[model samples]
Target: MASNLPAPEGVEIQEQPTAGAWGEWNPTEDSVRPVRGKHRVAKQRGGLARSSTVLGVGVIAAVGASGIATAQDRPQVTISLPSLPDLMTGGDSGHGGAGDNGRQTDGGSDAEAGTAVRTGVIPRQSDHRADAGEVLRNRILQQAESQQGAAEAQARAEAERTAREAAAQEAKDKVEAARKAAEAAAAEAAAKAEQEAKEAREAAEAKAEQERLAQQSGSYSLPTSAYTLTSHYGDSGSMWSSGHHTGLDFAAPTGTPAKAVAAGKITSAGWSGAYGYRIVLELEDGTEVWYCHLSSMSVTSGSVAPGETIGRVGATGNVTGPHLHLEVRKGGSTIDPLAWLESKGLNV
Candidate 1:
């Protein structure tokens, strides 16, 4: 015979009875067994509730493991069943499976069952979820910092490149300006040098001309040796046929020597129109000199050398006293003899 006996802790335990010890088993009697009290009903309900709660915890653990496996590169994880704590305890069975305290009839209260589930499973799952959340937050922050650093480095490099270009451009401009200034200075120097050279050449030419004039004054002599200058040419007078005096006068005693003024030919040695004797000498350049009012003529019509005696002074024709009248003619015109001699560099 098989007997369903309630154990000491309200758990049902089945036993095999020896043959013939109990009568033939009746299934209807077992099904229709009468409940003794409310404690027995409450004990049965509590046991079923506790089993269901344990099953629920296993399902939750499996879900947590699946979530963790999908979040990382790892092998698929196995769902392990949670170990359930024992709900029953040994007690005296003389009081029909109840403890000495009446409160123990329902095996254990709802509060104790809930405590076992939480202590074994809920705390471990909460800790795993918190760790996963922290790792994700840290990774996101590191990526943001790295990207910001790269952007700042690129901006600094670009700024340096722009500065270098500006500096190079400024240097080039300065070089160009300096080059132009140098060229301008050189051009000014060349112009100044050229002007100085021109001035020096003009001054040299003037000095040479002065030296040439000094050399020409040493070659001429006067016609008479000693005489007093009584009259000058171009003097206004009525003592002669013309209205003006046409010759220079040298007054001296009779028989004074008269010399040739330069090397020339004697064009005439005697003259009669002035009521006296006269002599005329022709120079090499066709300039003629007249020696009038002469007491005697020494040279005739021939070439005479300079400083040679030509005649003697006397109070002869065209003269009011013993004086020599000297006339100079060139190209049929009479000019100032003193002025003509000075032009030839003679200090007359």
Candidate 2:
């Protein structure tokens, strides 16, 4: 209590800071402000134990989260051991009363960390590196397989499209060919039908002409029926009276009936020398028709109509077998009966 004197220069004075106007200091949200980013400071020596523990925990967390393979090939690094006793005692022996006051100034922490890392404390890096390489290889192979599958699918689709197009074209071609063939067949059938129709028309016209002629020449008839002409008019023959035949000879069996050529009148009857049994008829036009060679006579006088039975065919003229010698005369001169009959629309 006497006059207080100043202590030595190295000694610190314990002075209590005053809580101004507040009775007992109790901390509250408004009483303290947390240190901002820029104002924060790292403790130098006293906080060694806490800093080492925090660093060790952070390293372990990093190693667990990402395998060693995630790190690139690099130089080895030092790591610290978090055992507090060894670290605290080592720092106490090395630095004096500062360590007792929870401050250690010695640099032993870096050496201890290096020793801990060198002693092979963590998991082996070689095994992790191999696992990482295998995983990378598998990923590459998977990607390649996926690409190949996509390529194959594209190729199959292209092939299917090409096949579909080809099939469509083939079907189109087949349809076109069928249409052309049908058209050609139809045209051929039409031409054949037209030709057949034309032939039918010509035949019908010919028949009509024949019918008209038959109707126009009423009562006209052949001199006889079922007769063969052995000699023709103007035919040179040794059996004829004039060395050349003067009439159309109608050969037939004896007693075969002979008819009138047309409506006519009987001019003469009976035989005349080599002219045998003969008859003469004069037509309405004064054209004379002579029927020589007769086996018998049914009507030897008076007028007669066409196709009336007049006599029988016989070998009567200057002749051979039974036959009718037919002659046409105009102006008392002989004419060819065959030609005259054709002009009158007779087929014979």
* Cα lDDT listed for each candidate: 0.62, 0.66
Candidate 1 TM-score over all chains jointly:
0.44
Write model 1 residue lDDT over 1-348, tens digit each, in one string.
Answer: 323332335322222234346433332333223222111112223444323323333433444456532111222122111221212222222223333244222233333433443333222344545776888888888888888888888888888888998899999899999999999999888888888877888888877755654554444567676778888889987886788888888888899999887788887777677838988788888988888888999998888876789889898776788988888898878888877766666655
What's the TM for model 2?
A: 0.39
Candidate 2, 80: how far from true, in Å? 99
Evaluate residue 98 in candidate 2 and report its C-alpha lDDT on the 0 to 100 scale: 42
lDDT of 1: 0.62
TM-score of every prediction relative to native: 0.44, 0.39
